[model samples]
Target: MDYHIYLAGEIHSDWRDQLRASLKEKPGVHFHFYGPQENHDLSDAIGEHVLGEQPNAVYKDLQASKINNLRTELHLKKADLVIALFGEKFKQWNTATDAATAIALGKPTIVIRPESLHHPLKELSEKANVTVDTIEQAAQVIDYIFA
Candidate 1:
């Protein structure tokens, strides 16, 4: 079996890398990952790089997020599953948006976030197929999928 997974959410950490490594190889199983730019610099400046500078921060962010959505939508549609992280430090509303889109597209979703966010994210988590508080726990789910 083969799986296409989308890793979305806060970019303030390298949890994606950890998740990728944690997935041990299963016989006859393969995994493909798709997501936003991992490099913070490029990810943050993509709009300015592609569309030139905006007049202000709000305009800049608007343009960047719009551009980024193109890739996010494409991958979400192709993915068999989506695992999103909602970190404590950054207010990554984009993570919520991507998870919602994944659910809308009928993709199985695993939400990985801190316990501190549980209450506020309850509604969204209720929609997810599963929710865990760590990348390792999320990896365990993927292992179960391909097992």
Candidate 2:
């Protein structure tokens, strides 16, 4: 069976890339990721200009919001489990939202909090299926979930 895994985390560094590489080595698993820097084309350039011009316009327009929301919904539906990573930096709103979405959908969700433990995620972690402290621990949980 194909196992779809949704990854939620900060996008500033190469963590996603590293996780993707490691997870891809596992058999029968597919990783889905949506990041902040997805739109880098001409339209994205214009959209960035619009966002820069209007602080209230978070997504450039309604279409962007719809597209992102639809994408998130599709991924959530397809995902058998969700894994969220909280690095040394801190937790991000988007990552928390993704993890919460998985929880709301009744999917098994794992949250990784490495350094900062006393953040907003602590509240959510209480409700999550599992809260891990390292990527290795998260992987072991994933194995248990899918096994």
Candidate 3:
């Protein structure tokens, strides 16, 4: 079965590259890299490695009323799991939103936090199906979910 995984992390952070590499080894997994559009080209990177498909911009326009609708629709249409990268930052709104949405939708969700971070992703960690602190641990979570 195909798994659509939503990748949550700080834009422009090195973690995105690591995530891309990790997911590349898991062939059938498709990723939707979510974050502020200006800071990074995560979607493009994922597209290059996977199917070269991008999210629908017409649907993702950020007007307050439409953004959540678009996100929900995308989740319904494309996601089976949500993988959040909680790096140096404790947690960001987008990460919270993605994890919450995934939980509400009954999708399997994992939150990965770097141990170096000062604060924990307490709320997300509490809700996540699994939580880890390293790329290796994250890969193990993926293996568990996809195996």
Candidate 4:
């Protein structure tokens, strides 16, 4: 079955572009990207690209409070998976909260941190199924998991 993967990442950073490109390459994969819409602008470009062509695929924009509700609804309505991009800094409440939620849900969480930065997640990184330094590495993990 096709998996619905939610991408969590820094909106303004280049990581967003990388994530979008990786998801686009994987045709059958559905993704729900949760992040700050104002800074990320994901809905305008990447989100539209993914959903525009693939009618079967789905993507949802959600606030932190809505994530669990959306996930539960989506999972019940269809099979799903969660792919989280654990970017640098736990400063943002939403990023940290989303990561925690994904982990708590027992979804297949993949944490991506830049090689330069040490893994910022104290206990949460331990829960992530895989941790990688780059988007390429994360994409490989996704390919492996979804393959």
Predictions in order: lDDT? 0.89, 0.68, 0.62, 0.58
lDDT (tens digit, per residue) of candidate 2 on 23-116: 4245665445544344435333454554454354555655455555667778877787788887777547777887888899997888888656
Worst 10-residue stretch by lDDT in candidate 1?
36-45
lDDT of 1 by residue, 11-59 (tens): 7778888999999889898888998777778777889999999999898
Cand. 3 TM to true fold? 0.63
Estimated TM-score per prediction? 0.91, 0.71, 0.63, 0.59
Better by TM-score, candidate 4 or 3: 3
Ranking by TM-score: 1, 2, 3, 4
> Candidate 3 lDDT (Cα, whole model)?
0.62
- Over 14-40, each residue of candidate 4 has an lDDT whose tens digit, in order, gives 676676687434566555554345344
**In model 1, which runs have C-alpha deviations exceeding 4 angstroms?**
none
Best by lDDT: 1
Write candidate 3's Cα lDDT for 89-134 as tens digits: 5446666666777778887887887666525467668778888888
Superposed by TM-score, candidate 2 places the C-alpha of residue 94 at a distance from the truth, in angstroms, of 0.8
lDDT of 3 at 90: 43
